[model samples]
Target: MLMIRPSFDTLYEALLTRDPSYEGRAFVCVSSTGIFCRLTCPARKPKPENCTFHETVAECMAAGFRPCKRCRPTMPEASADPVVKPLVEALEKRPGHRWGEPDLVRMGLDPSTVRRAFKRHFGMTFLEMARQRRLQEGFSALADGGKVIDAQITAGFESPSAFREAFAKILGQAPGAFSSKPLLFADWVATPLGPMIAVTDRTQLHLLEFLDRKAFPAEFRKLQTYARGEIGFGRTDVSDQIQAELDRFFSGTGASFETKIALHGTAFTRDVWRELIGIPAGEIRSYSEIARSLGRPQAVRAVARANGANQIALVIPCHRVIGADGSLTGYGGGLWRKQRLIELEQGYRAKG
Candidate 1:
């Protein structure tokens, strides 16, 4: 059933409508996301230009696209495994239930059997998933200005010591070690590309970057040092303001950022960032070009270094900088995301 050169128009229509007739008959691969899904997948559809049709799951996989979690194209059916679904449902019904072996036994479930099923399908025990949920809640509590004790209780930990131990294990520090004043709160914002961390205070956004960037943790440590250890986990008015603006920008209803930024860098680096902001959306420049504009033609290497050191993504528009011959250069965020971003800006600019 793996056919080549199928009508793009017909499959595109099926994808838009979630046509059941095409559920097992076709798949859609999104070049921007590197993901494949059944025609009936319920996730937000990518733009038509980003889509490619495949007649079989094998063909999709051959093209290097991973099966989407929402559609589960690699599975025998979309319902997921029979054993794992009920366990997942139970965890969802009481995500804060504090799971244990005894609780599984009381629910007419076998502890070993449940563990095997979850491990086989999800690569972790159901209890581990629940614990992660608890930890995430604790993290959210801290980010929302809750005290250490309040965060511990909110995360379902029975004692302060236990909560601190868990938090320290993950973040390499005790929660109380971070200062409460002049806080640079860390929070996560989800976009069509992926989750990004936003660090900010009441006055200005301090840092924003994609989670998968190799230098992200280092950047956070640098910020903590620069802020004189005043960095804590949480949100601020600046974060909320940026979140709304990012939503508008991604949805194509807005084209620019207006939030104030508190940058930590030398004079040259700060100047380079300001130059980045001056490039209009959907346009680009080379490092040599930027250096010339800055009247530092001999400092092209410095200009390139400054571009790579940029901490604030999107708002600073670093993705607009490319190689001299019109190819993409190294982007801190993955190159695919950079390509998708350029395409997005170009599409929006074309509409205007």
Candidate 2:
């Protein structure tokens, strides 16, 4: 996916032009109006200097802006399109069916257009998404220690090979090869920002990361090694603890996270992450400050690299790091989320 930092001028021009290409892909925040609107919003445009563009609605909300009333910016335009609603309803009705191009054509919809529509709205094609839904069910089944074959059957795969292929593609491992000893388990937890994958064993939490983060795969691999097992879906007491803590954290009720975390990093990296947690809520720190805290002021670049390698999100508090100039910098969870997390923590601190 292209990651362009939209400027105020560029966003204003896109809003003026009413670019359909930027419809779901971009959003604009009007500082003067205290509202954020989609690029296609029909509301009166704000001055260029008062406008800010963001990639997601969560970002705008994090920045203390409400959605535009006239544009209803939170809802995607394709959701209001004529054909998509029915198509989505049909898919929901028969989730067990293996959706494909033939199914779309049979429904009197052009396959390519349908595919594009689904991608534009959901970030994945219909078939890929259907497969994901099936796999999610299978993962839930496996949580209860169900047999591999049972999971395949539950997922509606006709053949074992196809089931294995699908399972491997998603979780990086085959079904039968998954460990039964139950060392550490991973499960998806939905958040206001987005869905996050949380992994834990009986003792401590291992990984908690945004599903769409660019470093997700690497984090998964590292977690697999740390847990000494294949990644699979299940829930444990630790998972429940982490989830509850996260709920409180995001709801702005509390910043205290009791989920015991096992850090896998070089000595230097671990040191940097330790200092990251020391940063109080509603406070910001720079890489140089972190390096200095570690008694190695010259290792600013090293500190930044270690911060990027953090697998655990809110628990580790890597979002508190900013550039030396006090500008937001690269964050694997997306800059918008980083901004929101900072704002959320700041609000909590203020309340205290």
Candidate 3:
């Protein structure tokens, strides 16, 4: 297999900043220390002259660098985090347990320390992570057409209202609001970055957004209304197809998303998205550049609005748009994810 890696300077910059977004995507080997560490490693930084970057731990080992004890770049990420490992293991053991700060106290862990550690590793506080997991359980049950009470029990929510509120917060509707027989289906698709909700009809995908995105609820509500409350929890043939394509993309074997997608935007917004789709995997463009391509050089702000209004993620390639100064700007999935996505696509460019 070809080794997919970002640019040398990019990896070096990640090493310098200890950027956690590059955690599994890249590793650094320090010649002076004879060891390799994760980009988020806490060890003292070495001079650039002594640094070598690799795409995988095996490559670092092949280059004669042992894994650093501090970061344990060779181990799975959760194992390297003192606070994340046990808590994650506990979560797996009891998927239905509602976690709180008091639970951290019972485990002899400081709540503040636990919060910071989980956020650093998982991009969410431990309580939030726990809540997401519980919701996943409930969502899965509901997707199978189980009763609301069954989902609440599966999610370990003692109060029915609490489960309903949580579900509403995520999907913009309570369990009863969803149609039992519906024209659209929504299901979770796990990716290397995070879990994304894919809403599709029988053939075309309508919406695809990261679950943790701040804009997801509003976007989903808009989608829900557009579908006339006919969205249900389930998967379609299109869902299976996208999942396989996503697997290949993350595995570096393929980067194509061939599933037919439905566009629900104004004519200009649709045109902007079509232009974004034309951008090569390894390349990036700015809003002004996109506007110029569309023969509306003055529509830079409108181009930006179209970019932000993108409902489908990687498929539409909104992350490919950057500031004219080459800075990453606001991304609905978070800037960290945008940076990591750009880095990942650079590998695809290298392969081609």
Best by lDDT: 3
Model 3 misplacement above 4 A: 1-93, 101-129
Reference-based TM-score of each model:
0.64, 0.67, 0.71
* Candidate number of the best TM-score: 3
Residue 162's C-alpha lDDT in candidate 1?
83
Each candidate structure's count of clashing pairs: 1, 0, 0
Q: What is the per-residue lDDT of model 3 for residues 142-185, given as tens digits with 9 covering 90 to 100?
A: 87789889999989999999988988887777887888888999
Question: On residues 179-296, what C-alpha lDDT tens digit does candidate 1 reach at each position?
Answer: 7775678776545565577889887898998866888867877888887888787667787777767766765667788999987889999999999999987888999999999999
**How much lDDT does each candidate structure score?**
0.75, 0.74, 0.80
Error of 2 at 79 (Å): 12
TM-score of 1: 0.64
What's model 3's overall lDDT?
A: 0.80
Model 2 score (lDDT):
0.74
- How well does candidate 3 match the true structure in TM-score terms? 0.71
